[model samples]
Target: MSDLKLTRRQSLVLGAGALFALGTRGAFSQDATTLTFWSVRLNTPELQAALLPILAQFEAEHPGIKVVNEPVSGNLVYPKFLTAVQGQLMPDVAEAYSYHPLQFAALGQMAEMDDLIKSWETSGRLKDVVNEFAYKKFFWNDHYWGVPYNLDPRAIYYRKDLLEAKGIKPPTNWDEFQAAAIALNDPANGVYGLSFPAGNFHITQHFFMGFMFQAGGSILDKDGNLVFGTTARDANIRALTYLTDFATKHKVTPEGIGSWDTPDAHTFFQQGRAAFGMGTGVLIGEIQRGNPDLIDKIGILETLQGPAAKLTAGFFNPMFVWNYSPAKEAAMTFVDWFTQPGRLEPLYAANPGGLWPIFKSEFDSELTRSQPLMQEMLAKVIPYTTDFAYPGTGVPEMGVIDGEKMFAAPVNEVVIGQKTPAQAIDDAQAKMAALWEE
Candidate 1:
């Protein structure tokens, strides 16, 4: 009360007499048990409707802690994240898109979770938890940064009837894939072998990385150096080659397809003009609502393999902590409770659709014969699945420039015949060197 305030060193969430005077930007910790959270994802009604109650329940149970869900999405959040960190005003817990944490990790803004994970590991709870994707992505460099909360795999959706009618089996290799694409493509008849969203980096980056990995290439090696060389470089070339052939060479995907993003692919598939589309496995439910009859005719396959095809990435809204957060321990306890398998089981069921779960424990023996379609995905008739993680560009601005403009666009340009693979690489290489290098 006498100009004395709480410090995180003493306890999380200063209370009672503790107070904060905003706008002056002085460091002051409260002694209360309240936690502040921020996220880049717009505070959509759906998310609020789903999660607010969870927070309320948590708070109700822990009378000592008060949880506040701050709306920081849209223009309010992304820019503020950097500012807040500088001001030491970051939230106790926040929601962030797939790779957003990576930027925070680089800045040392994220709190470490080694102790939480170690505890969870020894506890039977971690063993019962099934989401391995979340587990793997949480650990960055050498420590835990974020916890994957909700992630869905990207699966190729094709018109099974079209493929079967044309005697085209799903292509296994790049050559076969292109040939089949050529066969199913009838652009003149308003049918695209495949359709793509042009500007959305999330989708485009995922697809390109898929090809790169299948070709046995990686965006970065273990040391974080960009993977480049004949194996890696040619893998990039191969990805560009097939991508371009769809519209540029074979003329299957419409030139218009390149202008639209994933939603475009969704529309194309729904309208039946595109024979193949890549989208979130969760989209299967939406598909059922529109094309109710063709539901069974839709073919689902694990993301196509690269030379290292089984390696793919999944995007997630991860739970992150702020370094300056005074209530990290309480926040982490909530994270642990939220991701617990029993908790996740209901979350998974809330959306009954095609998405494959990220946790191994999420799927149990009871699900073996849950349903035919789910069975196929679980059986993974193809015998392999790949996963993706945070790309180097985790910040919003960096994703737009480095991943979208610098990485994916050039490769797309080659696919569209605007640049030769070599030229495309040179262009991308120059941009990447200039940007990523110190």
Candidate 2:
């Protein structure tokens, strides 16, 4: 992982065509000095409500600098940022994804942050507490590409009251999970033992990758070769077979659950028809805002462990400095100021619905630990969580999505005796292999 090697398959994921579109018009001089920050978050009234306070704090710290925040909502990111860069109107600092770091870093739209990190270390202001693999996700080839300000991790949400009423315990591993799913699954009683996004990749893929690796298969090995057909593949086949089967074969979950995306699944959980849901910590807050009773009934846990290891993606609102920013140092200064514990922890803790802190110190403090729901769940999670660099770009996301669609749809086929698990995996792998090869 440290070598930061890209698999042959991963290379296609960050396709150059997308990288080519990055804005590179460098019209602003380093000292002309306007820190235009670009992020889709600050644009929304919803996000700005949360962001404006931080903006006020940032301004208070730096008097000469003026901050211009631009948020580009869904579907307009490409054109919005592209036009700014093409017109020589680039953000002095921009919010970028961990997955997209390689693309932007390669595009020269973002700077190499090695020197900045070194300075942070010398000054004792840097806290790269994430695992080495995770840290390296932003560092590719030979440079540090992004400063991680926030991170996302997947967690398992279950109804504690229901489980306790039924005399069942939360699952600690896969076998226990399947058993719980079977026990809790009593549709006539109006409770589905377990639930997942049946058809959608955005809803299910992150959770599935954690399962796939735990099941002992992976999209590619460290050397970057596609390793699709193996026992781990069969494990994945069974794993999803269980997922889709809850709806199609077992009738535990409603049929066609796969088609729903994240919001849809959240709705399902909010309505209380499902016993459990897998999502980030934010989903819990959304539920509680409307129904506080739901909070007392729910418990959080890390996604259950699989055989290979506990593989999963960490969600991050990552920050990056434009390689060509008129004020690189100033942008980094903003970044450093933003991440310092004194500044960020209070803000994060205040938004209990958003993600938890990246710093373990903040995460372990009495302030965080005393809060029960997710804080307690972090106990079950902290030991097992692994941040697989999110499957970045078309090549990886596409392949995973295709594989998920191909595999999950037919899972019902196998459970109903239409195909064996091996056969299902073979069919799915073959389809995925073809797509990956493209």
Candidate 2 residues 1-438, lDDT tens each?
012344444444433222223343323444444577777533556566677678778887787556667776745754565456445566777774444455545445568878766776787545545444445456555677776666566777888887898888888787787777778877786667766664535446566656766766655555334455553466677555555555655566655564666677777776776777776666756765777778788888556777656655555456777776657777888877877655565445555645555655556666565557757546766445554433321123333333234545444455345676567677767766753553
lDDT of 2 at 401: 35
**Candidate 2 Cα misplacement greater than 4 A, ranges:** 1-32, 41-46, 78-89, 123-128, 223-239, 346-350, 365-367, 390-438
Candidate 1 residues 1-438, lDDT tens each? 122343431111111123332222212245447777664452655545655777787787777667777766644544676556445576777777665565566545577877777877798655654445455555656887777665555656778889999888877666777777778888788888887664535567666666666766655554444544323577777766766667677777777655666677777787888788766655665665566787778776645645555555455557777665657677887777766654544334444453334455666535435544455555542234433432332322233233234566765666545778767766766654443433
Query: Which candidate number has the best lDDT?
Result: 2
Whole-model Cα lDDT of every candidate shown, in order? 0.59, 0.60
Off by over 4 Å in 1: 1-32, 39-42, 71-77, 86-88, 124-133, 228-231, 345-357, 364-405
Candidate 2: give the clashing pairs: 110-323, 111-323, 151-315, 152-315, 152-316, 198-257, 198-258, 199-258, 199-259, 214-307
Q: After superposition, how far is residue 172 of candidate 1 from its true place, in Å?
A: 3.5
